[model samples]
Target: MQDITFKHTLPVQLRFNDIDALGHVNNSVYFTFYDLGKARYFEEVKRSPINWNDADLVIANVNANFLSPVFMSESIAVQTATLSIGNKSLKVVQRIINTDTKEVKATCETILVGFDVATSSAKEISVEWKEAISFYEGRELCK
Candidate 1:
């Protein structure tokens, strides 16, 4: 595995509905947290709000690992970083960590593919999008 330095983090608020019968956060809810992190990361990186009507990126794959249970009382945040970029897709990695102890509770990797909504087909990622992400990551990502 390559070393990843997360440049974006969003604190997540715990809600009562997030807890399951086991008194910990539900496994399914972790994806929601990751989604929130991704949304904020892109917004900050692009310096603008995303327009869903013109959105060209869609999730192609996702893999998650639940490392530990998160209690309702714990302070947690999600960290996100771009792992790599390809012609039509980019890979991202995220992790949920306890703010106090810095222990990771869950981790996820996702691949997002460029899509042409009008034609309903895959498309090459735009150069502008690539440049914005590369600038934010402080490294060259295009490959």
Candidate 2:
């Protein structure tokens, strides 16, 4: 925990469809929010040259921890950071928190793997990708 260093933040609003019968945002909605956060992180923070489809990386694994329920009425912001980078995979940690009261709604850590677009197999994490991520994280990352 200890508030992982956040590299990017994007505000999100819950839609009507995001809510379940219990009046809380459904579990699947977190994925969308995190995806947006990831996109924004790469675009604005990392400023990478790769697009989602053209990138050499792909999500290989994910582990999410839901601390509290998010409501449609509250304002939330998704925080993203590079958790770790490996030979063929990178780990990113994200958090969605209420902006007004600063309450954590959800947390997710995802592992993205580098792959050959044509061959569709895992490849080494590119040096450019590693440098881009490190620059955004604002510190030396754990190898």
Error of 1 at 95 (Å): 0.3
lDDT of 2 by residue, 1-143 (tens): 65576757899977899999999999988999998888888776555444667777778888888999998889999998887888888888899999999888889988988889989899998887788778778776648
lDDT for position 134 in model 1: 95
Tens digit of per-residue lDDT, candidate 1, span 70-127: 9999999999998889999999999999999999899999999999999999999899
Number of colliding residue pairs in model 1:
0
The clash count of every prediction, one per candidate, is 0, 0
Q: State candidate 1's TM-score.
A: 0.97
Among all windows of 10 consecutive residues in model 1, the one with the lowest summed lDDT is: 1-10
Q: Please tell me which predicted candidate would have the highest lDDT against the true structure.
A: 1
In the order shown, what is each candidate's alpha-carbon RMSD?
0.8, 1.5
Q: Which segments of candidate 1 are over 4 A away from where they belong?
A: none
